[model samples]
Target: MKMKKKNKGGLLFLMSVVLGGFLGGFVGMFKAGAESNGIILDVKILIPWISAICLLIGFISILLTFNFLKKSRKFHSLYQEEMDDDLNEIYYVQMYRNLEFGTIAFNITTVAILLALFISVSEVVILNRSNLTLSLSFLGLVLIFNVQKYFYKTIAIVRQFDLAFFSTPKDVLEYINSYDEGERQANLEQSFRILFQLNQYVLPVLYIFLFIISFLTGEIQLLAFLLVGAIHIYINVMQLPMVKRYFK
Candidate 1:
């Protein structure tokens, strides 16, 4: 227990330091960018704005990471508890960790994209005053579609896990200690209903839309799309028990 306490203290310290650095860099980046650009760096004033935007993104990244880390630590603690014969607690605990991991990935990606967008915007604004000439007619569209495909898949996994964990009563959600059978049945029913809806319609629809958008935008987006797919697959695999139980 002492060791565990020390570990959490270390993690919190790290989170604080990281958050402070990100926030500092964030403000400094924009201040420098804006000062460097003066007033009208371009007709759109894109030069200064992009850096500021990235700064804002970095700020968001810090927040999400902080939240993710905190939540994961909590889950880790829960994981130490003894399990019942049903072993449902483990499933919920695992689900929470997986969700936290997914959130971490998403935040990391956001940070990357935030940087990329700033860099790309800067290039477009200053070094090269040029129109984006990449044709969206063929492969570009394909790449975009693929990215969308994976994005939807990722969303589906996250949603499925969320609903399953929240709705399933047997193992992870065993806390609905209703003395009355009617109340317990209602709780289970509500959970099942929620999962059923999310697993069937919400996830599929989201995937279709994501895939379609990528298709329309072009193949340039494929790499981004694949990352989304990878994360989705990860969460799906990670939330194995809850997903399967509700799904079946």
Candidate 2:
């Protein structure tokens, strides 16, 4: 009886699953928000709260998932396998290099946007620069780029791992956490199933809210924004499977 080793497959599977669904669901939420539900508050505090809540949840979910994976079959092997430390480090570093770059870029851009937005909100800026459209567009770009970056990285991780597997079966048993190609595909199918179910429920309700809010507020511009946001969400959701399968 032998213990399994930590395979890159399981890590890749989970990353694809959670991140795929997370991205879809998050976009769905934005779509829902864009539908004019007539949500109103102190702009000063409201904007900050919106930003804070998302950033908090992103960090928290990552942390919680890290702990859960540590307990699940997804964890690295109890018995370590021998490897060159430098090689191991290099492998991980190369895989994660873009992820690091993306994060830093996202942070710098977001901070700049926020500062510009904050300045625009005050009388100090007479340029009328901040608007609903600009804010939403930036958010939309962030969502697209963030998801794109992760999927690109995920594919690279999978390919590199597959190549590594050509050398040894250690990755087959312990590295992948199981000896089933079915498991890899299962991760993807499960994520889409959840996403489709979620979108089916979310989109209609979001639209209804939009219709009602525009009527109540007498702001037809809100309707335009809602339409744009919902379209973006739909495009992302509908095309995501194709994008996911491209790596195959």
Candidate 3:
């Protein structure tokens, strides 16, 4: 068992290294292409295709997200209806799992929407000044409302779990005792830790890519990337004091 675990860990590390190298090479190739050929695409044609793809995917994600929210509500209702200890325990577990899955699904969909928004705005900027119009960017703006609606629905569904959502310190303590105790809370914290670690590792590469692309294109609007990258770094730095305090 120990050998198998070690082998699995090593395999994962190897795969990550290979994937990172491939991505780095791809970025380098793009940079080379840009430098040599002054790489440019016809945004008049490209923007429409990208906008269509984004809208189609965003619509599908929104539909699936609402479906997940409906399932969560169903699970919450079933959990409330159960009476026997064993049966209620089953329902409780199902409900908890549903909430966890729904939260992850919601986040994934939100990221897709945000990416669509980013690409839409980026493409708008890429368009020639004389040819620019909101008609090309309408889908992205539509997705902003979708994101807002999804955010509200996600919060509403989570709050349907009566034991969760707290308005006061006492309520928070009660919530911790009732819903977030033991392994569940630990898992939630561990997920955030993993995300933070991932951001730390990936953000530098992302910043470098942004710089490379901007240098190749001479587009100052890529300053957006710098602003976002700085905010990410600041957030990470802000968390360090708490991390030190925790260890101390």
Candidate 4:
């Protein structure tokens, strides 16, 4: 049974890698063809729309995040007051799942904002010298600052967890992993497993993205994609020995 499970898992991993690579190659080819055929988007028009959408999404995500945090804390307090109340504990877990989703949404928006800024600046520097890029760049910076403000507010709400604005990432991860055992711990582990799977599946696609951009832009230094791919594979390879030691 264990052997079968291992083989199944390996097969799934292989499938995911194959799928990711296929999609990545497809998109890269499409992008390259589009550029060659002069089917390009107008940056000045597209950027403002993207920025506005991100701003709206970011605001909604922040509000939902705060609401989830507040409900989770309330349930946590109730659970503490009546330590035997399983309902309170379940509610706490539910609220936290919502909070996690909200956090992911907010983080994705922030990344989008950063990407917008990078593109806007690159346009000004390389393609077109326009006031639109300058204005969009300023807007991106402001959105990023807003992201920081809400992010700090979130930390304040969860201050009981010993998280802070400037806390080292390792420290924050350690604190998170120190959650009370049982459902919360299981949920955290599940989240970690999902993230690991995503990394395995997405890293190849991301490398393809970088390679495509490099090819399009004539930037050979983007071979840093090789470095990224190496580190990702190395981490997975090293994990086998670590897992072996843990099992032993």
Could you tally the backbone clashes for each prediction? 12, 3, 0, 0
Give a tens-digit lDDT track for model 4, residues 1-248: 99999999999889978987887788778777978898763435565556556545545654565566556556545655665667866765665665566567667666665655666566567756554545655665675566556655554444355455567968877766666667467877897886686576567667766766665555654457778878787767867975899999
Worst 10 residues of 2 by lDDT: 71-80
Residue by residue across 1-248, what tens digits does model 2's lDDT show? 12233456567678867875776676566556756575542235444445444444444433343333233211122112327676555544443443334434445444544543453344224543344534543454455454434433443343333324133655534534432486557656876886775566556546555654454444554755677577658856778777889966
TM-score of decoy 2: 0.36
Score every model by TM-score: 0.28, 0.36, 0.59, 0.58
lDDT of each: 0.51, 0.48, 0.63, 0.63
Worst lDDT window (10 residues) for model 4? 154-163
lDDT of 1 by residue, 99-169 (tens): 44645545564554456455555556666754232121222234333433443344344333222322344
Q: How many backbone clashes does candidate 2 have?
A: 3
lDDT of 3: 0.63
After TM-score superposition, the amount by which residue 31's alpha carbon in candidate 2 deviates from its true location, in angstroms, is 23
User: Which portions of model 3 miss their true places by more than 4 Å?
Assistant: 1-48, 84-86, 114-178, 211-225, 240-248
Candidate 1, superposed: residue stretches over 4 Å from native:
1-43, 84-248
- Candidate numbers, best TM-score first, in rank order: 3, 4, 2, 1
**lDDT comparison, 1 vs 3, better candidate:** 3
- Those runs of model 2 whose alpha carbons end farther than 4 Å from true positions after fitting are 1-45, 65-74, 79-179, 221-248
